[model samples]
Target chain A: MIDNIEIIGLIAGILTTSAFVPQVYKTWKSKSAESLSLTMYLVFFVGIVLWLIYGISINSLAMIFANAVTGFLALLLIFFKLRFK
Target chain B: MIDNIEIIGLIAGILTTSAFVPQVYKTWKSKSAESLSLTMYLVFFVGIVLWLIYGISINSLAMIFANAVTGFLALLLIFFKLRFK
Candidate 1:
């Protein structure tokens, strides 16, 4: 069974992972990413991927799930950054 | 002593946290935030704060350091989003 601390981590993961949704939606609707930093998203995507690998190494389901989803979302943002450019 | 796994985690934390620096620099120099979603930064800031608390609870130095710095950076992004509007 998961403990309270793990639960907090899970919630934190969820919040951070899902936080990208609105930005994705907004960017999609606007079809403009001028103000968005491609470098930031690129670096962030690499970081998320590293986080995913680290999560896998540690066997933390929470980290795996969060980093996986966030990595995907960050990838999409990168794509949008390029496509919208 | 830190293990390989912890080192990976530390590198991941460093990448993710420092990823925002370019964004902050870009936004600061550009002085425009039209394409930035305020909601994203707001939610991200909250998530980072939660992550910091979770880090503290778990006594993970990496998490604490990453989240603390990221939280501050995210907050600055939020402020820029508002002020540059």
Candidate 2:
């Protein structure tokens, strides 16, 4: 059975993972990414990929799911940053 | 002794945590946040705090350190998003 700490971690993962959606949606809708930092997204994407690898190495389902989605979303933001520029 | 998986997690945490630095620097230097989504930062800050709590609960030094720094950085972004707008 999952403990309270695990539940907290799960919620935290969900929040952090889904947090990128708004930025993506806003950028897509506005068709502007001027103020968005390309460096930040690039670094963030690489970091997310590393996190995904770490997740897989440990076989943690939450980490795997969170990093996978977050990484994809970060990629979209990166694309938006470039395309909208 | 730290294992390989733990080392990987540490690297991942460092990457993800420090990823926000460029963003904060860019936003502060530009004095503009037009393309930055306030909603995203707001949600992200809350999520980082939750992650910090989760990290503490799990007794993971990496998580605690990463989330604490990331949370502060996220907060700075949020402040920049508001102040620059």
Flag clash pairs in model 2. none
lDDT of 2 by residue, A9-85 (tens): 67878889878898889999999988787888887888888878876775556667788999999989888888989
Per-residue lDDT of model 1, residues B1-85, tens digit only: 5788778778889999989999999999999889888888888888888888877886667778888999999999999988999
- lDDT over C-alpha atoms for residue A1 of model 2: 45
**Candidate 1 residue spans exceeding 4 A from truth:** none
lDDT of 1 at B68: 91
lDDT at residue A32 of model 2 (Cα atoms): 91
Q: Can you tell me which runs of candidate 2 are displaced by over 4 Å?
A: none
**Model 1, span A1-85: residue lDDT tens:** 5788778778888999889999999999999989889889888888888888877886666678889999999999999989989
**Which residue pairs show collisions in model 1?**
none
Question: TM-score (0 to 1) for chain A, all models?
Answer: 0.93, 0.90
Q: Could you tell me the lDDT of residue A53 within candidate 2?
A: 85
Instruction: Please give the CA lDDT of all the candidate structures.
Output: 0.86, 0.82
Alpha carbon deviation, residue B3, candidate 2 (Å): 2.2
Candidate 2 chain B, poorest ten consecutive residues by summed lDDT = B54-63
Best candidate (score: TM-score): 1
DockQ of 2: 0.74
